[model samples]
Target: MPDLAISATGLTKTFGGVPAVRGIDLAVPAGSIYGILGPNGAGKTTTLRMLLGIIDPDGGERRILGSADPLAVAPLVGYLPEERGLYPGMTGREAIAFMGALRGLSLAEGRRRAVALLADHGLPADRPIRTLSKGMAQLVQLLGTMVHEPRLIVLDEPFSGLDAINQQRLEGLIRAQAAGGATILFSTHVIAHAERLCERIAIIAGGEVRFEGEIATARARLPSRVRLSTKVADGAWHAALPADAVLRDGVWQFQLPQGGIEPLLAALIDAKAGIETLAIEPPSLHEAFVAIVGAEPDPVAEALS
Candidate 1:
């Protein structure tokens, strides 16, 4: 098996006598981008806190960077929590440098790195964080998270408040970090972000992990959809179509056959059916998530209640 930056088995947590996370398992491969995908209040934050040692799991075990105690490897991990904050009076550079100092980086080196990071991202480093826009402030904090050049990066709802442009920029930054040999794990409710970035993902609902594995694996749980248009539909080829095939808006829509499309293609050709168009679409991540989790109550809210 490949090296793992983070691993957990049967992790569980409770808040106020109510279950918040229930028997979660995860294996985050080194240098890979993984995602925890779920709706709001799905216990994502609780699970992450447990893995990072900020909160203890009620049951199960976790290892970070080959160490059983996550705190022992603190300097190697960078984290941006869902709740964002920075000293309002501190300049962007100072804020970043302070965060780096907490992680054992020298203030001078941190400031230097902060300058370069801000310049590269077209953000102002000398201005007080309170004077910056919300997106800018968030980006500064994210830069702080990376100032020490951590081996693993964790982001909680990282894209929650950004506009489309900033969100795209953040996505690019995530890709660049992963390219630089950092293991990145982020939690987000937006399916599009996870679909675009994650090599593997865990889908959570009702405080439980409903699915986990490669994105393609999740998508493959559902059959590919086939849309075919033919001039001669009333023929032997009709027998090749699926039993539930529906003809609507000049197209025959059905699930791809288990035997594959080759047999159907042969039947269509043998019957001289004039195939106008044929398209096969695999299930999207959104569709897979819905199929796995259905509609569940917000676990965090339930816990609070």
Candidate 2:
């Protein structure tokens, strides 16, 4: 069995009599990339805050890094908040070193690490935060968060402002971190990032978790897809196709029924249908997410742009 980096039971929070998070349980395994997925106003940030001990939970309990008190294990955790906060006058290196100091590093060691980290990412250590572009500053802040080399990294909406190029870089960084044995927990409404990066995921909607487990399990909630294009315009095999199948551009596309595609193929072969092409595609994470959480605005597309 794998160790849990974060464990929460019936965690709940409220503000002004309106529930922000309601009885959400999370178990993030050690040394894996985990994602909390939800749309805007889905209590993602609130839950993170509670787990980090930045805010008190109205009910339930949480244990982070095996400690009931998150503050006690603060040095083992690195956090990049949804809201960007960096001193305008501080140089990139200075900002990073300062964060490291807060995480228990000596000032001199922090500065040394900051210089190395900034240079590694192609940023000038001496450059002031205000002088850097928004994207550059974001990267600098991220480097600051990791300067102390915490065992677990938690990022809330880290992809919010990044363009495609930077997003890819961040993904690579995340993989690199996990490869180095750090557990990563991030919250995002952008489905594509979670699909690509997370091994385990929790889907939150309207302040509640609709599903939680392996990404493959979430995807398995939906059926596979089949696309068939035939030479024959009409045949008995048509009866074997799903009733919901749609024909578009001379191709028939539909969800495959459970059990297997063998039954469909056998039927087509028996009917003597002239088969031009047949394809079977696995269900996508987005499709499964939709199946679990219902239709949501195209936030992934919106986030990419």
Candidate 3:
């Protein structure tokens, strides 16, 4: 069996009287990038917090690197928070070094790594956090989170403030980290970004996970609609269509409810219809989100944004 980096079953969280996270289950594999996504307030951040031991789960269970005591296992995880902050008076190197120390690296080693990272990421060693651009500060924080070389990374909205160039760079860095044997969990609203970067994604809506699985698998769960253009007149193809098929503009289109399409093909062949072209357009994530989340962004996730 494959070793999982993080696993949670029936995870739950509450704020005041409200249940922020419902009994959600997560299974993130080692050396893979796991993306936690949702409309606003679907509880992505809270879930991360619980996994990091920053906030305890109200119920259920969680494990990291096979340990349930996340605090004890934290040394193996790197973290980038959604709410980013930096010491205004500290130089870029100093800020990075401080975070490394917090993650259990020695001061001297942290300094060495911080200096190398500053140069590698194109930030000046002497640049004060007070003078750096928002982007620069964000990058510095990222270096701090990663400098310790943990086995798992929980990044909350790592793409929030990144420009196009930085976004691409960050994506590459994330993939590299996973390649190096860390499980990366990042939260983002950019569906295309998540689609491009994550091997699998979980969409949480209404404080619960509405969907989870590979992108292709999720797409398969929904019915597939096909459009075909043929020689028949607009209304003439209806009689020959398979059950539940609809005709529009000399084209027959409908979702294959289940099972095989052999019957439909046989019907078309028996009608003596010469097929021109047929195409299946899969539903996109956004369409699936609307279908699963009730046509609106989760209120909390929106507020977090």
Candidate 4:
């Protein structure tokens, strides 16, 4: 087994006598990108806080970077919370340096790193935070989270407010961080980001984990779907399709059989059903998430409502 950067077992927390996280467990492999996915109010932020020791759990245990005490390993970890803020009067460079100072980096070194980070990411280092756009300010805070080059990085809803272009840029930055050997754990309500970036994911809803493991494994919980279009209205090939198959607009749709599609394809060919189009699509992360959580219109929209 690989070394774990963060691990928790049965971690529980309640706020104002209401449960926010219930018996959550996680094992994040070092140098891997892991996503904690759920809808709003699904305990993702609470679980992240407990793992970082920002708040004490009502029950269960957790370890960070091999230490039972998360605070003791603070300098090795960088975190960007769900709520974002920076001193309004401070320049982008100054804000980054301040965050670094809080994590044990010298102010001088922090300033130096901030200058380079801003230039590398195409941001103005000397501009006051108030003057920057919302996305730019968020990016500035994110740069601060990495100024010290910590071994592990944790982000809560890092992509929440960004526009499409910035969201893509942030994804690239995340991939770059993991490539540099830092373990990244981020929480997101957006499935597409997790689908594109995470090697493994944990799906949480109603304060509990519904699924966890590789993207492929979660997707495999549902059978592949097949969409086939034929020129003929009726033919012997119809029998070759699964019982669940339905015809609509000259197309046949069904679950791919357990015996696979080769046999069905041969049968269709023999009958010369004039196959116009055929596609076998694996279950998407969005579909798997819906199946697991029983949410419609996707979790993000459902959560907002």
Clashing pairs in 1: none
TM of each candidate vs. truth? 0.92, 0.96, 0.82, 0.95
Worst 10 residues of 1 by lDDT: 296-305
- 77-163: candidate 4 lDDT, tens digit per residue: 999999999999999999999999999999999999999999999999999999999999999999999999999999999998788
| Steric clash pairs (candidate 2) | none
Model 1 compared with the native: what TM-score? 0.92
Please list the C-alpha lDDT of all candidates, in the order they appear: 0.92, 0.91, 0.81, 0.92
Query: What does candidate 3's lDDT look like per residue over 168-240, in tens digits?
Result: 7788888888888778999876666677788788888767888887877776667777787766554444564
lDDT by residue for model 2 over 208-299, one digit each (tens)? Answer: 99999999999888888899987787888778887879999999999887767787789888888778999989888887888898977366
**RMSD of every prediction:** 4.0, 1.5, 3.9, 2.1
Say what the RMSD of model 1 is.
Answer: 4.0
Q: What's the true lDDT of residue 106 in model 2? A: 90
Candidate 1 lDDT, tens digit per residue, 162-244?
Answer: 87788889999999999999999999888888889998999998789899899999999999999999988589889888898
lDDT of 2 at 233: 76
* lDDT against true structure, model 1: 0.92
The regions of model 1 sitting more than 4 angstroms off are: 232-236, 296-305
